[model samples]
Target: MDNKINFKDLWAKQTSIEPNPGDLLLQISKMKRSNLRKLIVTNLMLVTVSAFIILIWIYYQPQLVSTKVGILLIILSMTIFLFAYNRSYTLFKEDINSKSNTDYLKELLAIKSKQQFMHTTMLNVYFILLSAGIGLYMYEYTSRMTIFWGIVAYGITLIWILFNWFYLRPKQIKKQQLKLDDMITKFKKLNNQLEA
Candidate 1:
């Protein structure tokens, strides 16, 4: 009777172990890559829009002549570009690299969740500020024609707020929270294995 344990069998069992950490990291990394791509695309679009607006303002410099209002719009557009630029830069700066597979997965999840939260909060705050700024501009620039432009600006602000509330923010928060939950599950499993 073979009473001695076979090292070969133990090795075989270990070799067949599931790659849970690796699989999760791969999934998370893929999601992050897609998100990064989306951010880049959005930033590019914002920059392009800002540039086009500036060009239009310059080209029609004579007719649409309200130096203060034009200046305010230009500043507002630049601010939007700056916000988008900063977000993209931060995302790039926080790219994930970890010493261990477990650490890598955890860090990646943390960074992604943080980024999502920061973006949603910043966007909401920005839209509120924008709405307020537009309202002030309309108040200051009131005239027969100002009514039409004021309504247009207010409409744009309302659309932005509605879009963020109905679409962007909820989606971002839900996705990030789901990722966080997955990471917590993995962490708990790792802790259990260590305790065992």
Candidate 2:
């Protein structure tokens, strides 16, 4: 008896190895829904924190123009980011009705474009605005603290922001892009199979 592996058997198995198209579409839907849920939760948390900060600014009624401007900037940045984020969520939620794979692919591409924009240019603007706003806001508050403690507090905040901007953010962006790319690839494959 020949000990050689049956290449013909392997080739035949490969032809039947395709995942069910229905299962794939279901998986894509589940991924989209999970992403939507995460976005909503994140937005809610951010909005809550921003509202708390704004309330503090309003209640204390600080006389410092810099403080006022800083608070406003912080609020503005949060609002702008949330608006863009919600818009992205809406795009993701729009239509999963895979009437044709082409339509589904179009929506996925749109989301990928928006995700790229959010992670790149928007992320930079967001962090910059947030950092500057926090720094300016701290100007008035830190004035009440001892010099050393004030410096320490500011140092910690700066380091945290820098870490997020340089390290965490890129990792997050790459992970998100990879997830989207995987979904896109799966859909494209399904489309090819359907057409075939």
Candidate 3:
């Protein structure tokens, strides 16, 4: 019996095969892209709201100390948001440009991890500054209701920071790092196969 493999048939069979590790990595990358998009949109909204508040303060209470302080806080928040927004955008673009699958996957995961850390840090900083600014405003305005709300807001922000640090961030980082390691192992296996 003569045995001969048809190249086209083999190619078609391979194409029809169920997706494996590589496809999963691509799916993860797409999910990351979507997540980054959502983050950018949310940051834009925050920036817009902050700008609106500053505009209102400028028009209504240009000379008020509380308004001035609010403006400063808004500016600080915007700056932090901008840093995260721009870094994420750049990383997304770079990931899109990467031609090698393994390299792209590794770089994308690193970028995502870094972006998460930076985003959290910026948010924590913004909340802390917000708490201080709000507290100052309440004290200067001499309103019991304002002071109560400010304290509540500060408490909520502190709790958020604690929850993120203790519960969310560590788990997220570990998950991402595990994914990256798996991808690396798969890549090494593929390389070894090619060598063999």
Candidate 4:
């Protein structure tokens, strides 16, 4: 006579642990904060750059139609982009955790869709317009410079823009999308568990 227990029985006796609802909300809040911080930094940089360019146009008084047009276009594009970015964020309340899970998920899904549209369509157009605007704005200024200096200026600008477009932009989009998708998955899992 031996006291023997099967592995299945031992497993059955183990207590089930569910994810803490509060913890989930906290994690979601952290993600939202991080995203907002990035957006703010980006927006500040844009505003600074736009202001600097406007000042240059005002002070230097470049005597070319193209320069004026370029400067105006670049400033316009920057303003538009910044406004759109800020407006989209305004749709998102500060504390997503304040809402019920169903409501939170709904809002999150809406955010995901808006972000996708902005990243996929609006941003690319903005980039193109900005690039063209800069090229135009610099045309008058660079025309007076030596070929080497002009190339250097445009080359540096192009490289920076390219890096943002090809590298940073994609990385950010992927990371954000992953975070949202992961959170959505967890929410679904929790909902299912409740239904069960």
- Candidate achieving the largest TM-score: 2
RMSD of each: 7.1, 7.5, 7.6, 7.5
User: Per-residue lDDT for 35 in model 3?
Assistant: 81
**Per-candidate local distance difference test:** 0.64, 0.81, 0.66, 0.81
The TM-score obtained by model 2 is 0.66
Model 4 whole-model lDDT (C-alpha atoms): 0.81
lDDT of 4 by residue, 1-196 (tens): 5568677898988897989999999999999899989898989999899889889978898999999889888988788788778867776656787888777766676676776677556676777788888888888878899999999999998998889789977887787678767876776776666567
User: What is the number of backbone collisions in each predicted candidate, taken in the order shown?
Assistant: 0, 0, 0, 0
Task: Give the range where candidate 2 is weakest over 10 consecutive residues by summed lDDT.
Answer: 91-100
TM-score winner, 1 or 4: 4
Task: Write one digit per residue (lDDT tens) for candidate 2, span 134-164.
Answer: 8899888888999999999899999998898
- lDDT score of model 1? 0.64
Off by over 4 Å in 1: 1-3, 7-40, 60-98, 101-113, 133-142, 146-160, 166-168, 181-185, 188-196
| Stretches of candidate 2 exceeding 4 Å from the true structure | 1-40, 96-99, 182-196
Superposed Cα deviation of residue 91, candidate 1 (Å): 4.8
TM-score sort, best first: 2, 4, 1, 3
Q: What would the per-residue lDDT of candidate 3 be over residues 10-127, giving only the tens digit for each residue?
A: 7876645576988899999999999878877978887787788777766766555775786677567677767766776676675355457656555655665576576557656765
lDDT of 4 at 152: 96
TM-score per candidate: 0.51, 0.66, 0.51, 0.62
Which portions of model 3 show Cα errors greater than 4 Å? 1-9, 12-44, 59-67, 143-196
